[model samples]
Target: MESAQRHLRMALDAARMMIWDSELSNGKVIDSTVKWFAAGTSLLGLPPGDLSQPFSTFLQIVCPEDRDHLLDTMQEAVDKRTGYEVEYRVQWPDCSRHWLAAKAHVFCDEHGVPVGTLGIVWDITERKENEQATARERELAAVTLRSIGEGVITTNAAGVTDYLNHVAEQLTGWTLEQARGLHISTTLKLIDDTGAPIPEHAALQCLRLKQAIGASSHNQLVTRDGRHVAVEESAAPIWSDRGELLGAVVVFRDVSHERKLSKQLSWNASHDTLTGLINRREFEVQIADALHSAKQDNHVHALLYMDLDQFKIVNDTCGHSAGDLLLQLLAKMLQTQMRDSDILARLGGDELGVLLPHCPPDQALLIADQLRQSIKNFRFVWDDHTFELGVSIGLVEINHLSKSMTELLIAADQACYLAKERGRNRVHLYQDSDLRLARRQGEMLWVSRLNEAFEHQYFRLYAQPIVGLCGHGGGHDEVLIRIQPAKGELILPGAFIPAAERYDMMTAIDRWVIRAVCRHVQSVRDSLGPQQAYVAQRQPAPAQYSVNLSGSSLSDEGLRDYIIEQFVEHDVAPEQICFEITETAVIANLIKAQDFMAGLKALGCRFSLDDFGSGLSSFAYLKALPVDYLKIDGVFIRDIANNAINRAMVKAINEVGHVMGISTVAEYVEDEPTLAVVRELGLDYAQGYAVGTLRPLSVSD
Candidate 1:
């Protein structure tokens, strides 16, 4: 018996078990009559005092959350007269809580009635803690998946859908219960940009490639309801801790808004916003295609370049808002006139282009005239004002004879210019033998030379003396621009001035003249001795330079500031310079010219209205302009001595000027007789070959 008890105790110590034995009566366990053995009492941190306690006393030590469960489990085991096991938490004497597992067996009497119970209790704190930590990790992973923005789907090794996050279910319109065990491709339907089914699912591809596979931007998702949604997706192979292939995880997001924005940007790049027509870049592309067809297939096409006449008049009379509305209206009207196959494009401000395929020059001319007449009849109304507008159309035939796209465009533009020159609201056809077009082509070549001249200092300044007729303002010279080529005679302004003005380069040229004249005057002043300079200052300034300004420059608001900067840089006096403008320039931009004149005059600079009597209403505008000089037009002055009508015009201009207290100068006095006529008219100044010929401008000797 002693040996058996010692062996049992050794077994219990090795397994860390506590044993409890309770006696029962009336087929139920009695209270406060329990036996403890093999460190049973020590397991719960209780003292051994006969080690017997009521069942209710033991229940008090059990954790409050586990007490009811433990009582119910024990009662069931006792009633069934069977064995059972349970796990519960206990609070020990030291106030520390731990997990305990109990296995109990019921001992019954011969009639199948429960009498006594024997149980073994052991601490399971560490094992229970490990299980709880693992559960927490799994729960955290699930919550993180639900919280993330990107839709996440995980598949098994066989490419079968095994798990789906909340986001994935929403995106695919499939719940986890509905998608489980289904093939990934069946759950997530993917198609290409063309709406064709992808050959293999991204998840399957990832499993085959054993690497990450990203779907193209063109990928789309087809929901169960037959709605297509743009999506960006990537699938990566999932691996286990043992480096074995588990499954693929697909992550995706919707990119519909971004793709829509991208398409809008592309549309904006090729179309004009104001007119809702294809822009110049797209028009040029159509022309290139036409040229290619003409070259390769021997096909004929026609191109029309249209320029709206009097567009500036409308834009200036009304505001730019009215101008925009007029352009929009015109674009719609022109579109209605074109055939379905013809392409119409807005080339730029007040200019448009049309490409007609399989049309000959004769047919194109009729069409161009139709368009011109339509524009001519169209009256634009803004506010309470109504204005009639016209168009100049240039038609060029594209055939095997067409050299290139650039040549075709240039030909069309030249034709359009000629149409405008010949009286607008008409169509001009391009011909190689057109002398006027040839002259225009020559002028286009001068544009390049003029740009080069500006860079290489090839331009020289020349002056023609303007003698005082009334001795009011003498020793003034009219400044002129000349170009000296590398190996030719000097080129006059008449050779390139028209091209410069047409190309919007006159403003730059005018600024250069201002700087050069200012520099020259400063150098001359520095050269003179102090006493001589003082004496010359007391007398009339050595010479006042009259620089001619174009109509474009008269409208330049920044020109005034630029001139002021030049004066400060060169230390030139304002009274030494006089700006010369034509009557046409003054009438074109009367308000800007008046403001410009007023600003400069306040600073002591002089203004001369040149080419007076050229316009029909010169006298009507004369009273409005504030000027110090009125240079009569050379047309009237060159023949004043011979033509009585010319003499009368000059006399009228001189009288109008004297009445306004403005000085008058006569141009083109080529002979002594003309000079006498100018003096006889009582002009303030006479400028011609008779007074002095063209010579390089220089400082006083």
Candidate 2:
């Protein structure tokens, strides 16, 4: 027994030496003999528990959250009779929480009876905290990816989609399941703004270079519907925690709405709101392009400047509504007459411009003349009122002699002025000398004066009388307009009318004339009693006044409304009005003018074709014009007694008018011989100074 005790003591000493020198000082060991029990405790630390208690009882002091897992690990080791390992939370003496890793090996007797266990415990608190923090970071990363407004997609180096966020799914119309592992190009349908395919190489460049692309930077994406969506996008290389590149991440946003808005704003800036035609700014751009093309191709073109004659009268008399309608009609007519290659635009008000590409001087002149003829024949009617319109056109051809767009326009404008001067409803070609003088005179001065004339009431009305051809005693009056000049003597229609027309002042003038005529009728009506009233009514009463209209006015669809308003405002009966139009005006826009006249005629007003022989007068046109009276041209009447040609033409015209049940009037009847000739010719009325001079009626008349 003494010998056995010495051996045991030697073994204990060896074990102690081993434990003291080794790194695992906290290790414990137990004997397998049933009769012998052993326990080893750490000297470094221990929780405040009964040291004599079983190990399981001591483990119960660990944190409640980790107790179940630790218990299960210990039970498995005991049941298997094998090595055991566990990681669990522990409570320190100070109530602080800690993580511990405990490893134990179970020992059994020869008969498989459990005897003891050996283990080592280590404090793993720092590692546990690190793991928990990593878990939290991963959760936060996932949440962030899902919450972003822009689409987020991750792809492998091969450009295959690996992950997609909800926003990406919405933007691409593809779910994460559908996009996963698919080729990005095929799944996203990425394209350029012009619908061209975006190559995988470009995407790789963005990913590899870690660059960002913006919508204004020209990044584009295509949607499932084949619509190109402008996009602002960014890409960056995706990396692992180890600082190694994994793949790439891309973020993109749809900018289609913004792009559309920008385009709309651009369009509004360059186009007219009312007419939908190109605005002045756009016109300038087009002109510049045209000039450049002409210079490059060595081509010739023409710029036609058009002015509406007496347009203001329609507006003033009928109202602005009629004036707007007239402008629209004129625009349509100008468009109709122009070639497909031509560009026609309303410069403003009654001023219009036409650009004719590849046209030479001669062709330009021809076009201008056709335009003039068209304007000369237009007839506008408002309610029971009919008005005549005339257009003056100036044409200039682009040649080597032309220096710039402005110069060409100036030349064309000067020619247009000449057309008005020569008598409105005519076409004039630009001359170099005319342009030189126009530039020197700075004729824009006239434009300013015209604007002032309407504002200051510097316009006046003159009258011409219409007498009965068979000496019926009483005569009718035809109203004429004359403008008073600021610096010179009162200007005749022949002088400043051209300037007024060019400047779009005619509509205002026409309005004034209508108002003046209505006032005159009011004044005349107040003075005349019932006896004179009948005579007045029968003898083309002063109540029935004839007013001329511009071609622009005739084409105006709203003319009827304006006339009705005017008649209502003036308290004049529709029958008390007679609207005179030229035959040329009727024939030019026969369809439009006929429609206008028919509308007015429905209101019980009368129509007369003035200067019947001067324009394209046909029996069909005359019948269609719905005129109650036909005025013979004064040219034929001036020499009617002697000139057989004149007499024959007059006789023929009279016969045609009478045959059509239209009353014919002979103008320029200065003497008894002219009257006698007109009487023999079966003329209806005669108007000239020979019958009576035109004079303003006195308040007592």
Candidate 3:
């Protein structure tokens, strides 16, 4: 029994815990494994004491802050004869403080009744301090996320949203209280532009790839309210100290406004400001593509170069306001005149260009004339000052031969120059012939002489008698114009006409001829006393004069008013007058021609389609033209008696003309056989020398 007591004491001394025995009856310490004296006292503080004392309470060593609760719990355990555990601060006699975990239970004497309390204590201050520091770090991290300006979302290892900072809540249109514990995709919906959820948006890719990743520019974010915002996204995985994947974080920002500005700038760079049309630079870009297509597809396209005539008059007469209004109105008119497939642009001041993709030269010429005439008839009633304008058009076929943009431009410029020269308001086909080449190169020399002739009135008129092959009506005389130089013989119209037309002097020339014809005819009528009138009536119908009009005059919207003004000025009767227009001119300005013919025909005047069957598209314009005569083109009629094709073509044209109720005239009849053939074709009139010799008109014509 003594050895067992000794062994119990030794075991208590060797324990890591401080062992204590207290009397439950008085709440005083009876024994301790270590002596409570001097420097050996632990856990509870003691100032000084004996190894074995009657009264040395452990309460004195317990910190005052924790003493009451620790004592109460120990007493309760003693009363219930049960075990208890507690942690409390220990204030030692050396003025040091520490934490202790205490465990106690009531012990029974040999009679099995509670007599004392036994307990164990451990110092746990280091562990407690470490736990407090870890808690502070967590709180600091949460505050940092909340304070940051950029949005942040954190998900758990299972890809569930566990936390959201203040900024993240606003960006995602959600709150931490609402988003917590939901799947990341549900709380922070990321999508593509099409509104489909992005696979990378789940942020699991970051974990799988073990690196940061980003969304494409097309990525978007759908907010909780269901509004979609354009966004740039980036994501990275959270990690543990051991380099294990813990969760993920996503970051994003909106970019809708940025995109809009970019697109607006692009549009401004390519569009015109005044007319809202595509500017010249972009038009040339489209032209390059068109030219490339023409070459690669083995097809043809046409370019229309237009110059508005008399536009400056409106600008000079009225303020620039009227001119601007004219341009705006004409731009609208020209746009309406083209097909939907065609492209139109204001090339610059008073100039417009059209791109007719896949359109042949024939149709292009028709379109140009249509635009010309449409404007001619358009009456500008601007604030009590009505104005009319004309358009001169140049056409060129875009083909493999058009090697460069500069070449195409040069061709278009040349053609437009010719159109203006021949008479404004006509479509001049661009032909690379020797004659045209010479006209372009020889322009400077001709311009001065033509001007000098106009100034000096060095121009003369001739007449060709139209023999009535049908023998039922007296046909009129076709009047011709010639230029008489001061130093040389009379000049054929062909020599100076091309230059005159190119220089935009045709309107003046045509006006001069009309005035002269009226005066000369009036003189003849006055010369014929009543007896001479009977002699003049012996041929057939009255001698109404057939006069030629330049294409430029046709496009002059004021030409009709000007013509009426001239007739009043010259005392010429409208019934005794007929106007001749070539096939190219009529077709080039179809609408203008149609309106012009309609206007004049209403006044009992007559119109004739000159040089018919010269173009492949003569039949197309014949139905639209209100004409009284179809002068078969000199080419088909020149030698029809010898050429089978020419005879066949003339026969066909004559048939069509008769069907249309138009009389046909055969021109360039150099020999009798051609005249015989013309008569056999049931021709109404023949104007060639074979029918009658060309004569200078005298008082008796």
Candidate 4:
């Protein structure tokens, strides 16, 4: 018996447990013997002092909260005559709690009544502490995922849905219970921009690549309810502490509003805001494509450039509000005449362009005539006025023979202008043998010659004196530009002005004229310095040099600053300068013209509205311009001696100018009869050969 006990004690010592034996009576431990191992001593912080002690002494060290459970487990084991294992907390000598597991078997007699029990106990505190810490970390991660704004979904290594946050549930329209265990692609379906299902899902790609992945802006998420929502998505692989592939997490947000705004911006870039049609930039792109097709495929196409002939009359008569309505109505009417294969665009104000693909020149001419007739027959009514309209159409064939997009447009524009020149309503066709188009080509060549003149100082400045019709001495002279080539006759403004304006070269020419005029005025000022004392007593008024500005110069914001610089450089008085602008030029860009005129007028410079009695609403628009002189158009003055209508118009213009506190000047006064009529009309000034012929502008003049 002693050998058996010694072997059993050695076995218990090897396991680091303590062995205990108890004699039970009525479910109570009457006596017990205890054997302590290394584990037991470390747990209780005590050495084994006695081999025998009452079992009640050990119960005193048990945790008060667990003592009942331990006693009940022991009683059940004794009654059932079976083995029992129970884990309970124990108090050490320092009053610190530690976990203990007891395992034992109940010994019974033949009647199945328990008499004695044997058990083993060990310390399990480290395992219990680790389990509690792991539970806390998992709870924190779940709460964090739920609190975030972005939708988050997790999948397992097999790409099956494992978890989803509240935002994910809302976005996918699927509850966690319904999504769990399903393939991630089934729950988070994606479609491309074309609405084609994407086979490779972001989560699946992340799992396959074992790295992060992202979706493009064109990607969309399909919800459970069959709604497609634009969403920005990114996915990253979840990994274990040892770098093992565990799952993937996908985060996403709805980007529908952002994507919609982007689409709107793109549309606005290519379309005109007022007309809701493709703008000039987009029209040029289509024309370029047509050119490519003609060059590469030997295809034939046609382009029609149309300009409304009477649009300005309506606009100037009524206002821009009426003009805008007329344009919108005309656009709709023109669209009905176009085929599905035809492209129409608003090239600019009162100008529309048409592209007819696979159309020959003959068919293009017919279409152009039809459009012209439709416009000519249309009538526009605004407020209390009803007026007829007209259009000039230019047709140009596009084929492999076409030179370039720019040349094609220029040819079409030239033909359109030729149509207007030939008559008010007509269609002009551009061909290689067309004489008018040939003339246009000659004019285009002038663009280069004009540039050469600027470089080589081949330009000459002339002026004509504007004297008062009452015989008062006049010192104001209108400056005119002429191109004097090295070997040819002087080229008049009529020869190059139209071409310069067409090619947007007028602003540069205007600058040159302004600088030259300033320099001329300064030279005259220097030469007249000695004579100024005598002239100051006689002609107290300053001799103003009038320079004509083109319509294009009005929109040149830097022109104002540049003019200031030139005036300062030349040291010329602003009172000696007068800017003459035509009525059509000012009316074309009224706001810009007003601002330009106001800026210079503040500096003591004067403005003259040249060709004033031309527009249909001259009297109405006259009040809007700030000017010192109103130059009656030569059309009215050329026949004023005999034509009663011309005399009446001139009389009205002079009367209006006098009433507005602005001076009136008569243009094209070539003979004594015209001058006598101009003086009889009580006009302010007369500028023509009758008053003073054109002469070279020099300091000696």
Please report the candidate that would top TM-score against the real structure.
4
What is the per-residue lDDT of model 3 for residues 2-95, given as tens digits with 9 covering 90 to 100? Answer: 9996786566556546655455454322332223333224545544344433323555666787777876777677667788898888777678
Residues 1-701 of candidate 1: C-alpha lDDT, one tens digit per residue: 99997898788778988786777766544342567763677768777444777777778889898888887887788888888899988888899988899898999888887788887788898987677555444544664465499787888779999787887888889999999999999788899978999887889999998999965678899976778889988888766533557777888878899888987898889999999899999899999999899989999999999999989988999989999999999999988988899999999999999999999888888888888888888888998999898898888999988888888888898888888889988899988865466676777898999999988888889988988876665568889999888889999889899899888889989998888888888887888999988986787543389999999998887999999998898877788899999988899899999889989888888999888888866477666667988888899988788899999988988888888898888888899999888888788888888989988875331
Candidate 1 lDDT for residue 143:
40
Local accuracy by lDDT, each model: 0.84, 0.70, 0.77, 0.83
> Which is the winner by TM-score between candidate 3 and candidate 4?
4
Q: For each candidate, C-alpha RMSD in Å? A: 25.8, 28.8, 32.1, 24.7
Candidate 4 regions exceeding 4 Å error are 1-147, 433-701
TM-score of each: 0.45, 0.42, 0.40, 0.47
The true-versus-predicted C-alpha distance at residue 185 of model 1, in Å, is 3.2
Give the candidate number with the greatest lDDT.
Answer: 1
Better of 3 and 4 by lDDT: 4
Steric clashes per prediction: 1, 23, 13, 0
| Model 2 regions more than 4 Å off | 1-147, 192-202, 208-210, 216-221, 225-245, 375-388, 439-701
lDDT of 4 by residue, 1-701 (tens): 99998897789778767865677665554344344444455656566543444566777778888888888888777777888999888888988999888899998778776778887887888877666545434643764465499888888789999888888899999999999999998889999878998768888889888999965677999999999999988888776533557687888889999999999998888887777888888988998999999999999999998899889999899999999999888888888987889988899999999999999989888887888887877889998999888888888999998988998888888888788878868888886656466676777898899999989888889999998767555558999999999998999999899889888999999998889988887776666766784675365346478899998999999999999998899886677889999888889999899889889889988899989868755567667767889899999999889999999999988898888888899999999999999999999899999989999975221
Worst 10 residues of 2 by lDDT: 17-26
